[model samples]
Target: MSKFIIITGGVVSSLGKGISGASIGKLLQLNGLKVNMIKCDPYINVDPGTMSPYQHGEVFVTTDGAEADLDLGHYERFLDVNMTRANTNTAGSIYQTVIDKERRGEYLGATVQVIPHITNEIKRRFTAFENEVDVSIIEIGGTVGDIESLPFLEAARQLRLEKGPKNVICVHVTLVPYIAVAQELKTKPTQHSVNKLREVGIEPSMLICRTEKPLSLHLREKISLFCSVPTQAVIECADAKSIYHVPENFYKQKVDEQIIDLLGLTPKQKVDPKWFEFFDKAMTPSKSVKIAVAGKYSELQDAYKSISEALRHAGMNNDAKVEIVFVNTEKDNVEEKLKTADGILIPGGFGGRGVDGKIATIKYAREHKIPFLGICLGMQCTVIEAARNLCGLHDANSTEFDPTTKDPVVDLTPQQKNVVYKGGTMRLGNYTADLEEGSLARKLYGKDQIVERHRHRYEFNPAYVKQLRDTGLKVSGWHEGVLPEIVERTDHPYFIAVQFHPEFGSRPLRPHPLFDGLIKAGLKRKENK
Candidate 1:
């Protein structure tokens, strides 16, 4: 029988519920349980694929090509698991499923409501994971008492009844804010939050209190008394030096032990030696490498969450601390900011908001022989930069930015020309590309053919491929007929650009080769200097 643990947040959003859930999941893994994670989003969008980075942060892509919540990225990094499309679903997606079934007469003409139809669909998503793993940890987005969260909460309540109390545990995370005037942490918000949750027909078995300072015994007792949880079930969550330290932090607080006791499960093992080793190396690096990321949404680090973690993973593999310098191409002098960096990266983005600055940065990296990596929109900009500077096509550009350019080096694929719906309509998920036998890409990947996750609609123009290749630029990887997937400069030290997002596939224990290659080149440059 599969057990279920549902994590919910209260008192605020961004309270680290995702990290809490992931840390608990890690503890379960250490105990020899096959743990799986699922993220329940409250938004109406079917996925974050079409949402702006400013609106929803980074859209994390699963191995199966599902564009998921950024929390899924945290789950993958902590659990070291490859999440599939089934691991993520939004309120919009659930409603869409219910409606699709209703249209097909699965409901038999009964008018569907939020109670039996929507909530049932939500429970079905939870039940789908029952047979696949020993335990499934589901994180509910949004705080308690929100109108959007009612259905998800109700579904969780019903699931506990259906699966029996022994098989279900509700873990609620709430904030314990401190006031400077009183110089004390308040528990009113957390109590009210728990009160609100209880009103929805569910009581949290454990409460993870988020606090700025160490939790007091008095405060724990107060929270325990008010929230109706045992004194030990009120676990304190102090801020950690790094998010990776969370599992150990939770272990110190006995959160995992409490969870095991509540679930009535016996551990096969109490610790994973490999995890401790990885954490040790991650904390104590011998040296450091600086990599500058030129991105439009650089102000908010969460906007480039996966890229930041991928660089860290590569840094760990190379035994170097990764220092990421965020350069906002929309405002900063791109060349001057990146002049002292060991390597440069141009991440994906939409619009022409900072194209000129990005083009200048790419040109600088190319001419100076600095190790450079371009991803998605970044790759398109690289091609455009090469076409304009080397091929002498003065007005070369992507049609996405300038439709009236004399030379359209990048344009929309034929398949996307007539697509009217903007959301979830793109060349998404995974696609295979044929790698040139002796090319840099094949060498880095150690494979002749590669499958990568893509989330773009534009491609390098086939008409300009010959012209660009003749100018010493290499088309190292390609898709079915003339679509360029990977480009490299043979003359430069380590300049490669790919239309796919490699950062999505990178893991802490197993860093992606492209990132490892870039970090290696950067470390060499540092040593040479």
Candidate 2:
């Protein structure tokens, strides 16, 4: 059976609970322990698919087509593991399951209450994969005192009791603010947060203090005595230059060692102290490039979390720093805004809000031979732009933007045409695409076929494939020979777009070839100019 590590937050939200949990998870994996991480979101959305990016950041898609919370992205990237539907559990999903069971009379005619019914399902999600891995880290969403987190917190309290203290442990991440005027670090907020946790019957085994400055010995002891936690269990998490450095910081405090002793788990191998290979790369970079991420949600940096991280990984590998410049696609003169960029990227988004701007940027990149890359909706806009300019189709547009245009260069997939519901109804998860010989994608991937994650409803309409290609558009990659997966132009130095989200598959040690290729092209442009 797998040991459980339940991470909770208190005092307030956005305390880096996800980062704390993933940091410990990476430390566990380095010990040769098979580690799995799951996220328990408090939101009632069945999934994050329909939520606004501004509201919840990015909607991270899993290998099994699960549109899960963004925390799962942190888990997968830190542990270098593939997360699936079972890894994401939300209030909406649990409640929906229980109500469906009730409709079928599975409760034996008894009035189903929230406690035994809802909490039981919640615990089921925690233990469903217990025997399959050595350890499972579950991070609870929202603050401890929030109304939405009550059921989840209660379920966690019960699980700890049932699994025994040795089999399960709770780690509370709370803020310890430093008052600038007082010239001192405060611990009262943390004390109250712990008190709240204790009131809910969860005695956290450890308290991870998120503070701007390192906690002094006096402060740590004060927090431990008041919070009823061990002195050694008071971990300090200071802000770092990179998230990858988090695991290294935890390792210094021997957080993983303390955890193994608390849970009585035997390591599969000796833990390595030099587990800072990724962090080391992140700390040092000789050069830099400015890549403008022009998109619909550019105002919110979190909306493009994975895409930005993927680019950062490529930069680390290339021994360069990636300076991301956000360009609001809703604004005017997008081409002029992107002219100074070493690279121009158009990330995925829904609706036609900033599509004309994306098209204008694509046209500028193609005509000027500036390195460019597009993804999902960005890819669709790339095709639409080509049809309107090169193919001389004055009314070219995507069906998503203009359904009755004279040339529907991009349209919804046949299967998506009838998908009436909005939630989880897209071409998602892992898919294979065969690359053409001598194509730019083939050279970059160095393989005949590759698989990547996708999450989009529309695709390049196959009817216009011939017309676009006849005008210098190269359909270099395809799925099932009928659907286009990648497109490149014959006249440009580097102009490529893919229907799949390669960012989802990128890792720190092994960056996705597409992003790495873009970074390489960007570096070339910087050098030549």
Candidate achieving the largest TM-score: 2
- Candidate 2 Cα errors over 4 Å, as ranges: none
lDDT of 1: 0.91
Per-residue error (Å), model 2, residue 461 = 0.6
Q: Which parts of model 1 are misplaced by more than 4 Å?
A: none
Clashing pairs in 2: none
Model 1 error, position 439 (Å): 2.2
Per-prediction TM-score to the true structure, in the order listed: 0.97, 0.98
Number of colliding residue pairs in model 2: 0
The candidate that achieves the highest lDDT relative to the unseen native structure: 2
lDDT of candidate 2 over 1-529, digit per residue (tens): 7899999999988899999999999988988888888899998999889999988999999998999888888988889999999999999999999999999999999888889999999999988779899988989999988889899999998998999999899999999999999988999999999999988999999999999998999999999899889998999999989999999888889899999999999888887766597568667799898898989887788899999999999998899999999998898578778878999999999999999889898988888899999999889999988999988899999888888888888888778998999998899899999999999999999999998899998889888999989888889999989899999988887889999999999898889998999999999999999
lDDT of 1 by residue, 74-152 (tens): 9988899988888998999999999999989999889899989999999989877789888899999999999998999
